[model samples]
Target: MIMRQGQQLLLPANPLFIWFSLIVAMMLNMLPVGRIPWMPDFLAVVIVFWSVHQPLRVGVVAAFLFGLAIDVHQASLLGQHALAYTTLSFFAITIHRRLLWFTVPSQALQVLPLFVAAHAIEIAIRMLAGGSYPGPTLLLAPVLEAALWPVVSVLLLLPQRRAPDPDENRPL
Candidate 1:
């Protein structure tokens, strides 16, 4: 993979860090605050982030499992989030290489559609299962998630950005 000029090379992501971030995201989603219609899905954002950045380690299965956890937590349709997240991960993985070629903000713009599709899948499944419209504010969820892309990218990539061994004579 040819990196963009000026792009710092990131170290291999630790498996433990990957799973830890996923758990933290899940915990954030499980918070007691009522599920507001416009609130972004933190787990979805993290899942997509990892799927794009480390597809082999965090793929559709992880997304599906996390989605199921969220489904149970929210007491919504069993497969609603599972299917949505699975689709999101699949798409992110498919485009991961191409997506990495762009700047972070440009990548965010590219991923906006993926977020929209994920939320649309969730809403569609809900409506099919006889749930009422969650109102127009529901549209904000995907937009918010896309807006969070850069922040998520920076924070998650932080650990890998550090020098494995800092030495005055070496620059990496």
Candidate 2:
């Protein structure tokens, strides 16, 4: 939706939408695209977005819990995703205010490091547990997640972005 010059739409952010999107992201992560199971980390992207934009609604605990759910669902090492998500949330919370000052694309650029950090945590966990590297291809997930950031922001904000009033013609 385009806004005329000096026009701004300030729709209230609904907490429900935040929670619903997280659940959907979890389900999407579970879907198999191949035996590789290398889907973009949608949960991380969503958590970071909400943690940055709606900190009160989605926080470290939520990120930890969702990460645990993903861990269990994926049958991976316990607490791996949890640790990564919690750290990611912490970073998001710390950066949220600064993030608000930038445009979405710039925000995504800032967030790219967080996604990489999350993946680094995951890799470190695996290495500590004696699990072999999943290969260089594993690195692609974060890049894809970062690339999807702007798209996610736009889609998630659509509900909150009010369209210009069509009733401008109505009088007085």
Candidate 3:
């Protein structure tokens, strides 16, 4: 893929690193902090990140499976997260190419709507399942996730930023 000017050339992402990061995000989400209404969904953010960065490897299926896991963990309605994550992954994949052209902050702005949509889907699903409203604070989750985008982009891209083989005469 042709890169934008001044964009750092990233090494091919390691499959192991990608999966490990996903697992770590999942574990973070599972932390027993009594799920706050405004708490950002870490797994959702990471899944969207990977979906945008490595769509071929971490697409809708992975999102669905992880969403199922989250649903089971949280004991929410079945497929609530699965459906939301699947949609999120689909949209992330759709925009991945254009998104890469933007700077990190700009990318965050671009993805905010995606995160909002994901949360909205989740809330809609919950309500349809006869669940109580999580309140106005729920609105904060997407914004928090968007705020986290740049940090996640930086950390997850670190492994791919290193030169495969450092050389005295070469600078990548």
TM-scores, one per candidate:
0.98, 0.88, 0.98
What is the lDDT of every predicted structure here?
Answer: 0.94, 0.88, 0.95
- Candidate 2 clashes between residue pairs 3 or more apart in a chain or in different chains: none
Q: Lowest-lDDT window of 10 residues in candidate 2?
A: 1-10
Off by over 4 Å in 2: 1-7, 35-38, 163-172
lDDT of 2 by residue, 1-172 (tens): 4444554465768888888999999898888775462468999999999999889889999999999998998788999999999999999999998887778889889999999999999989989999898888887888888899999998998888764454677421
Look at candidate 2 and tell me the lDDT of residue 19.
88
lDDT tens per residue, model 3, 25-139 = 9999999999699999999999999999999999999999999999999999989999999999999999999998899999999999999999999999999889889999999
Stretches of candidate 1 off by over 4 Å are none
Predicted model with the maximum lDDT: 3
- Greater TM-score among 2 and 3 belongs to 3
Global CA lDDT computed for model 3: 0.95
Compared to the true structure, candidate 3 yields what TM-score?
Answer: 0.98
Per-residue lDDT for 18 in model 2?
A: 85
- True lDDT of residue 134, candidate 3: 92
Error of 2 at 9 (Å): 3.7
Between prediction 1 and prediction 2, which has the larger lDDT?
A: 1
